[model samples]
Target: MRMQLETCLAQAGGRSDPRTGSLSTPIHQTATFSHPRLGESTGYDYSRTTNPTRSALEKALAEIDGGARACAFASGMAALDAVVRLVIESKRRRVVCTEDPYGGTIRLLEQFFRPVGVVPVYVDTSDTRAVLRELDAGDVAALVAEIPTNPLMRVADVATLADAAHAAGATMVLDNTFLTPYLFKPLQHGVDIAVYSATKYLSGHNDVVAGAAVCRSEEMGTRLAAIQNAGGGIPGPMDSWLLLRGLKTLAIRMDRQQENAQAIAAFLAGHPRVARVYYPGLAGDPGHERLRRQARGFGGMLSIEVDDPDLVPRALAAVKVFAFAESLGGVESLITFPTVQTHAAMDAAIKDRLGINNRLLRLSIGIENVADLIADLDDALR
Candidate 1:
């Protein structure tokens, strides 16, 4: 029988030994698993291709993402790289992506993929008409989107985009790291492939760096697995174990994190120094209505535009509780200026087009007390 999300979190990958009844899944850290009689062994043969611990994590991920299969990787970029490789065959040479994608993804497409004959086209995915217009042109092999996007908090209509992509004979891939499967399941919304920086919300504690790809069909799963093995970006046994442990508490952690974020977004929205707040949870926000229709919740990420660019350094320095950091989706709150930190390498023109203003600040809300986080922001705004 299918289980509820909370039950899935607690028991999805906990395959206990019939003899011992251990509650937690043990890490199978060996580099290779021996076959008893030349070929008489379970599916696992080597660590590079598979490990018991990693298999557990992959199973859990597949369950969470509602996919036929899932693959785990060393980092989020590795997952993305594998997905991109799947679409970059000799006949299919171009990738259409959101103008406001994560900076690392932008770098991968421009600096790396471009040189290898895979061209990347950036479009404003929020504009459904524009996205459809681009797909009609037909050079695209894959279309990638990040819902309630990184740093910008731009929400795209996944089902709409997926329809457009399918009509154009292109695959639709979504980076669901920001919202996590708890708040949004891209597959149910028509996404063909769902990718996650498992290092983020899935691993919640910020202790592990990992990535995952979940595909709707066994064929896509095999293709992703092939690229993963060829590229050698599979996650280590320890990281897989930690990620599995984190998955157990994902529901509870996200409940608190989402609450903290809503409170903080309210605080920032009314602050005099704040020019604009980007959060789907806020009523009447452009994406709020659409988000209600497509997502389970508004998620835990928010972005604010300060009135002046110069105010950023002062505001960043003034915050007493929130840590100034680059990566996000940790147990502790984090604040960063993307133009200078995460998206520094992106072209200035591209940054402007994506509305990544110099004065914008990205906030990754943690499970901290709402009052305490607000007070810290109140003092910083002063």
Candidate 2:
């Protein structure tokens, strides 16, 4: 039966144990399992390639993404690296990507892929016509998009881009980390691959460090799994178990967090100190309508531009509730200055061009009381 996402998430690892009726999926932390016969196997040979905990996670991810299969990795970057390697095959070295993606991804492509002969072509994927034009100018191996893009919250029509990519003989890879499978799934829109930094909304808490990729077909999934095993960036059984634990409460956390974000975005929009607020949750946001169509909810992530760049430091230092930190999407709220922290790998000129400046601040709204979050920001802005 097609259970709702909430039901699926709540019962993330609720499969009954055959021997013990344990509600949670067993860790199966062993490095290797014993075999009875020399030429026989139990479909459980090594922990690196497969394990009960990781298998459960992989299944959950696939189910949520509506994909054939998924591969878990040590970090979000590792998952992205695997996808880049998977798509840029057989001399198709040129890949088109979102103009503003996670800085780490840009670093991976420029620092690593570029050095090894792979080239990255960046465009505002939200502009469908621009993307179509780029696809027309071929030699593109893959088109990677971060829907509701990092910090900026730009929305793109994934299905339209997927059609363009396919017509141009390129695969479509969607970074669904911002919205996650809870709010959206890229494969449903004809994307070939869906990637996530499971550490964020998927993990819910600020603890686990993990990544995931769901392939539209079993063949792509098998290829990604091989890359994961060969690259040795697989998540440990314990980490997989932690992600399972996080998934149990993901729906509730996201619901509350995005609610708080909507309230805060409203607060900031009216504040005199705010020059601009970038949150798709707001009806006035450029991406609001498209996001509504593509996602169940506008996510908790948003960015703000202060009228005075100088006040950015004051606001950071004054915040009593929001943590002045690097990462985001924990139960605790986090404030990040992406220009220096998250997107430091992006060149200075590109940062300026994209409006990722010192005046801009990114907020990772948590499941805090809506009033408290708004008050905290008001106090900081004052």
TM for every model, in the order presented, reads: 0.97, 0.98
Alpha-carbon local distance difference test for all models: 0.89, 0.91
Q: What's the true lDDT of residue 47 in model 2?
A: 89
lDDT of 1 by residue, 265-362 (tens): 98889999998999999996889999989988988899999888888898889888899888888889999999989898789987887678888999
Return the top candidate by lDDT: 2
Worst 10 residues of 2 by lDDT: 12-21
Give stretches of model 1 more than 4 Å off: none
lDDT of 2 by residue, 1-382 (tens): 9899889898986773567878888988889988889988878899888888899999988888889999999999999999999998747878999999999989999999999999899999989999998899988999999988998989999989999999999999999988888888799899999999999989989998999999999999999999998897989999999998898898999889898999899999999999999999999999999999988999899999999989999999999889999877889999999999999999999999999999999999999887888899999998
- Supply every candidate's count of residue pairs whose N, Cα or C atoms clash at under 3 angstroms: 0, 0
lDDT of 2 at 352: 98
